[model samples]
Target: MRTVIRRTAVAVTAASLALLVTACGSDKPDAKKEAPAGDKGAQSSAPAAKALSTAELEKLLVEQADVPDYTVKADAKAKPVAAAGSAKADKAACQPFADAIGGTIATPAGQAVRMAVLTPKDSGKKQSPEEKALAGLNALKSPATRVLLGSYEGDGASEALNTVKNSGAECMSGFTVTQDGETTKITAATPMTLAAGEEATSWSFTMDMGGGDEAKFNLGLMRQGNTLASFYTFSLGGSVEELPIKVIDAQEKKLA
Candidate 1:
């Protein structure tokens, strides 16, 4: 599983860093300024790409109408928070991934639209007493999903996606992150297969919180033209075996 958020969905208490494993887009000072490899020739003669503003990002983000069954909040309205780039990985090579999952990018000027999504706790249908009692165990595999829609300039978006791809692949063994004096240990990182956008890479991780508390989380990155979409999901019911397909599909459609 991966780290993202809890689907208990609507209410977030303190914005724990342990469940944040989603947003990772940047335009860091050191990144090269060029066009994406696939479109270099065409973009070379085009004007430099401009990032979408916060207002534009909001319009592009999902609204309750888009996902009527769940709760969605974008930008500053999204709460129980963690900032991207606030976490540091013990291995320098894995820092990009750390910042990625932490919900912030490593670059200073990268523009992004952030959101929090939660699935319904109740299935909306009347449940038998037995079903209600078993609900605790049969609850949504992933209750909360954290999202990032990052827009880039030049090749910044592609560069960000590649950085995440290389690092998520290379750091599968495990690593630790330190944010605001809190430490999170990742016991495992498992890659996943996915089809979406122009290109995508995915992973699920096991996190140990001591006291024998372990949770599985899923993290995925999808590239859509000059933008990057990152989804991180977590579960309190048990292993989050699947990504939030409904949420992802809706967001991707909005991006398209």
Candidate 2:
């Protein structure tokens, strides 16, 4: 993923360099100011092209393959949470976090899916609150190496679905959760990468869930202004809810 990002960066740099060269060449009025007699016939058609209607221009833009469009997730939800407080309260406060499940849902696609998230404790007994939270999560029995957070890009609905498909979990089971008088079945799991402000990459995994319903979930966490917020989208038409979140910890014993 880092390699993908590096390549993109290099491409942008190259494009900018080309643009700079073009600008520098334009500064020299003596350089090829007049077109050749054979090219004059082609220049006559330029004004007609510029006279195209707005709709025509839009159609042309759509037909262009190289034109990039920022994929927008339709009815996408973006929830934000803070990163302060005790671990238990923080964990229990957010159902999504507690459930540790999220992903896109399509018709005939919604089903029973269970997910879990885990991280290493490192080598600290009285670890930081964040560390304790991660350790407690690690203690839970699940796929040992599949822990992560993820970010989805492009069309909102598909992006969410892709987030789940890429989560590296077997089939996603739609967990039934009640919210606002309606029982909403949603994908539960942790995120691959925690995106604070800037865009991040999506996470993927490949593992088998032995009869026991256990899978580490990735949580999208970031500090919003002064408070922390977690990202979430319930459905394609759902609005993003920025919920206040925190990380708390209880006194934990040292691991041998």
Across 1-256, the per-residue lDDT of candidate 1 in tens digits comes to 2233232122433342212222121111111122244212122233535776655665776666766545455534444335555677888878877766766554423444444434334444466877654543433333556676677766676677777777865678888877666677888888766556666667787887678888787777766666777787765556666666666667779877
Residue 73 CA error for candidate 2 (Å)? 14
lDDT of 2: 0.23
Please give, for residues 87-150, the per-residue lDDT of candidate 2 as tens digits: 1112222332222222212221111111111112232355677865554443332111111122
Best by TM-score: 1
State the TM-score for model 2.
0.20
Candidate 1 stretches with Cα past 4 Å from truth are 1-11, 14-48, 74-84, 108-142
C-alpha positional error of residue 192 in candidate 2 after TM-score superposition, expressed in Å: 1.6
Worst 10 residues of 1 by lDDT: 23-32
Give candidate 2 regions above 4 Å deviation: 1-174, 195-219, 233-256
